[model samples]
Target: MTGHHPRQAVVTGSDSGIGAATALLLAAEGYDVGLTCHEDTAGVRATAAAVEERGQRAVVEVFDASRPDAGATVDRLAEQLGGLGVLVNVAGTGHTDRVVDLPYERWRQVLATDLDGPFLCAQRAARIMIAGGHPGRIVNVTSVHEHLPRLGTAAYCSAKAGLGMLTKVLALELAEHGITVNAVAPGEIATPMTGIAEEDAYREERPGNPVGHVGHVNEVASVIGFLVSPRASYVTGASYVVDGGLSLMAAHGHDSATGWRSLS
Candidate 1:
C-alpha cells in the first residue's frame, strides 16, 4: 500500500540542536516546515528565518511538549502547512537525579515531556495523514539511554525506553495505513543541551566512542532526512543509533568501575 506522503513536515523542539538541524535539512529537501519551540523564542525565530532562506515555507509555534494540550499545537501546525506528511517528535527533557533522590514531580515531568508528548503528537499527526489519505513519516528522537541504562538518568532512560517500544508498536499498527514510525537514538552530541558548541564537536574527543569525536547535529539530521525520504518508505519500527558507538562500550565502561554503586 503505497501512498503519496506530502512534503509538509512539523518538527517539535526546533529551536536548536537536532530539531533545528532537521528542519533545515527537510527544507533543503523541498519540505515546507512547521517548527515548534519550548522556551527559546529567539532561537526558533532564527531557525524559521534559515528555513525561509532555504526557499521553503516556515511556520513557528510555541510548543510546551509536557503540557496535555501539546498535540493541539501539532494540529495547528499541520493545518498551517496545508497537511501533515512528516512529524518529528524531538521535544524532550532529562533528569540527573538517581531514583532514590528523584522527586515524583520530576519523574512525571520527564516522562510527560519525553514520552507522553511524542505519543500525543504522533497520534494527532497519524490521524491527519490517515484522513488525508496519504502515507506519512513519524520520527521519534530518543536517546542512547533508550537501550542502555545510565547512572543518574532513571527518569530519562525509562521514558526513552518506553518511546522506543512505542515506535515499534505504532509501526505495526500503522503499517496498514501506509505510515512509517521509527526512532533515532543519539549518544552525546554537541548541542546546547550538552553545553557544547557545534564548532567544538570535533575538538572534544571521547576515547570510548568509536568515532573519536562527539557527533554534530547535522550528522543525526542526515539520518533522519533519509528516513523521511521516499527511499525509506518500506522501513519502519527501527531505532537508528547515532551514538558514536558509545552504547557499545557498556561493558567497557563498567569494567574498571568499582565506584558505580554511588551516585556521587
Candidate 2:
C-alpha cells in the first residue's frame, strides 16, 4: 500500500455549495465519494444522484458537526466506502453577531462546528490512512475570514483561524506518513451560505472584489480537486486563497473614510 492511491473520498456538508460541487468533481475524477449533511437529507440525496449519474459510488450520511461524536460519523462513512483516501472538511457554520452581542452558546456552536469538527474528522481519517498504509489527502474548507478580521463575525473568524493553524500542524505531523493536509480559504462564493444562488453567481456584483462578481462554487472545488489529485502530491501545509482577490482589498477597505468603521 506504500505506493497505492485510494480512490475513495469523503466530503462533509455535501448537501450543497462547495461540498456538493467537490463531491461531483471528485466523482468525475474517478473517485467514489461519501457525502454527508447535517439536516439537508433531500439535498444530500440530490448530490448522491448527481454523483451516481457520473458513474461513481456515492454514500450519504446525516450528522451534526457540532456533536462530540462527529468523528464516528467519518469512520462509518469510510467503512461504507470501503476506505477513505481523501477527506474534505466542508461542514461549518457562520456568525454575524459582534463579540459584545454574541451569546456563549452561539460562540461554542460556531467553534465546535468549524474547528472541533474538522479536527475530529481529520484525526479519524488520518488513522484510517495510516492503518491501511496508504497515502491520503485532507483538505479543510476555511474562509478568507480565516486570515482577515471582520466587523461582526468574531466567532467565525476565530474558529477559521484556529482551523488554519490546525491544518499546518497536521501537515507537519502527517508528512512522514505520506498524508498531506491543506486548507482552502474562499471569499464571497455563490453558495447558500453566502446567500447567493449558484446560477446568479456571474450576475451578482461585488465591486469590492477584484473579480467584480461573486465566485462560483466550482472555482473553489477545482482548487480542492487539484489538492487531492496526484498532481499536488508535493503540496502540503499550504493555504490556497480562492477569493477572487477579495482579501487583497484590505488596504483599500481601510482607505475609505466614510462608513468604514461599520463595514463588514
Candidate 3:
C-alpha cells in the first residue's frame, strides 16, 4: 500500500490542539493523514510537516466545517488518499452567550459548526468507507458539555449533546459494515482554544478533577488513537470521557447565593 502507508485518515480542525495531536498520533501509527483547518494556515502546515516527519503523507486544506461544502472537503480528501479508513470530526465552534441573550445567528453558527458539520462529514466518510469496503473508524470530538450543562454555554452544550447521541446512532448503523463510531469528550484541555499559550507548559489546578490539573491535547489524542486502532474493534457507540473525573463532581453542589444550594 504505497510502501508503508497502509491506512488513511481525515481529521477536521486539525490546525492545532487535540485535532493536531490526533493527526500526529495517527501519522506515527503509519496512517497517511488528511487535515482541514479554517484559518490557521501556518499551524496546518506545521501539522503536515509533523506527519511527514513521522513518515506518513499529509494533505492540508482550508475548510469551514459549518458550510454546505463541508462534506465535500472530506470526500475530496478521501479521494486523494485513495480511500478512507478513519474520520475524526474535530471542527467546531463554541458560544458562551447566555441563552436569554444569545443571538439567533450565534446559536445557528455554533450548532452548524459543532453538530451539522460532524454529521455531514461523517455521512460522506461513512459512504466512502462502506462503498470501498474499508471498515473505518469515526471519532467525534465532543466536550464534557455533551453530558454536563455549563453556565453561558447553551449552544455549545446543545450541539455537543446532540453530537454524542449522533455518535451512538451512527455506531449502531455502521456496525453491520464493521465500522466503529465513537466520541471523545475532553474537558479543559490545555490548548489555544482554552486561552492557553502554546509555548507555555502550564497546568491549572482544578479542585474538582481528581487528576488535579487541566489535560493536555496529547492525553485526549491518546484515547482517540486507541479508539481508532484495531485494538478498539469491539468498542463502538461509546463516549469516552477524558475529563479526569470532572464530571464526577456533578453530585457536589455549590454554595447558594439565594440561601438555597446551587448545583453549579
Q: List the residue pairs that clash in candidate 3.
A: none
Q: Write the per-residue lDDT of candidate 1 for residues 104-151, one digit (tens) a residue.
A: 999999999999999999999999999998899999999999999999
- The clash count of every prediction, one per candidate, is 0, 0, 0
Q: How high is the CA lDDT of each candidate model?
A: 0.93, 0.93, 0.88
lDDT comparing candidate 1 with the true structure = 0.93
What's the CA error at residue 107 for candidate 1, in Å? Answer: 0.5
For 1-264, candidate 2 gives per-residue lDDT tens digits of 258469999999999999999999999999999999999999999999999999999998897999999999889999999998999999999989989999999999999999999999999999999998989999999999989999999999999999999999999999999999999999989998989899999999876677879999999999999999889999999999999888877777655534443447
Give lDDT tens digits, candidate 3, residues 1-264: 111112999999999999999999999988999999999999999999999999999998899988987899998998888888899999898867988999999999999999999999999999998777658899999999999999999999999999999999999998888788999999888888888754442347665566667888889999999998878888999999999887876555563323223334
CA shift of 244, model 2, Å? 0.6
List runs of model 3 lying over 4 Å from the truth: 1-6, 198-202, 255-264
Q: Please give the lDDT score at residue 216 for candidate 2.
A: 95
Q: Compare the candidates by lDDT and give the number of the best one.
A: 2
In angstroms, what RMSD does candidate 1 have relative to the true structure?
4.0
Ranking by lDDT: 2, 1, 3
